[model samples]
Target: MNITEVRVKLTEAKKNRLQAFCSITIDNDFVVRDLKIIEGYKGAFVAMPSRKLADKCPKCNSKNHLRSRFCNDCGAKLNDKRALGESGDESKGKFKLYADTAHPINSKCRDEIEQKVLAAYKEESEKAKQPGYKPPAMEVPDLDFDEDNTNS
Candidate 1:
């Protein structure tokens, strides 16, 4: 799939590791939004759109975020064991509370998307240094919003 366009929105805080957020249009038809550009220990990298992880509360069967001490709905104490490492490796860090919503299937595709997004992010970051530069609208346009005259 060919990437047609990439839009980047640089983050304001200079001290944070998060550098920017981006959206990409694929083949001028498919659009994906909310990709993050982070400054990791190695360098800037693109992270696919992801959502926070959650689990069902045993007491209420309500969805509560991972690492929660108590169920949001029932307020019952959660099992601490459930908060263990995501990969089940004892040596690994804390349980991941987030997972990627969309990601490339292979390293090749991942590299392509990451390269394109990071390039756009760099260009946008430079523009941000200009005196009158204003950030672009990061919000994805609502496709379902009716633009034509209505209530006729």
Candidate 2:
């Protein structure tokens, strides 16, 4: 009823999130079927058989494979030392989120970018509407006047 371990292939890939299938082995030595892979925040995560957080390292903040402890490069411990208290369930371990920079899918960045783009688009749309369109909405404006004009 949990994921014991996971294995993955390191591929020289391009931008966006890493998407792939994973095999989950239960405590009884029985394996779960292939799970669908969508763009994951980090790399791949196998959440069955036992409990594991894939590709999340707490030390140097570099994400790595689930089975890997200590950064593959910096040697910072992948699992946080504090996670030992989590009822022996590694999945419940504290995993500082590390977004994959080398490559990312459109999912994460899409909303942020879309929001900005939508805001810009909305601004432009409003600007375009200013030429002719009018809506029944209250407008709050701060006013300033020249002293010379007031002197009259």
Q: Residue 17, candidate 2: how far off, in angstroms?
A: 4.1
lDDT for 6 (candidate 1): 97
Each prediction's TM-score versus the true structure: 0.83, 0.22
Clashes of 2: 12
10 residues in a row with least lDDT, candidate 2? 143-152
Candidate 2 runs further than 4 Å off: 10-12, 16-18, 40-152
TM-score, structure 1 vs. true: 0.83
- lDDT digits (tens) for residues 1-152 of candidate 2: 33354332221232423222233344649654333222344532322112233454555666565546568768876554443444655577444322222221455643433233334334433554476754323221222111111100
Each prediction's total of clashing residue pairs, residues at least 3 apart in sequence or on different chains, is: 0, 12
Which residue pairs show collisions in model 1?
none
Q: How well does candidate 2 score on lDDT at residue 127?
A: 53
lDDT of each: 0.76, 0.37
RMSD of each: 10.1, 23.9
Cα deviation of 56, candidate 2, in Å? 44
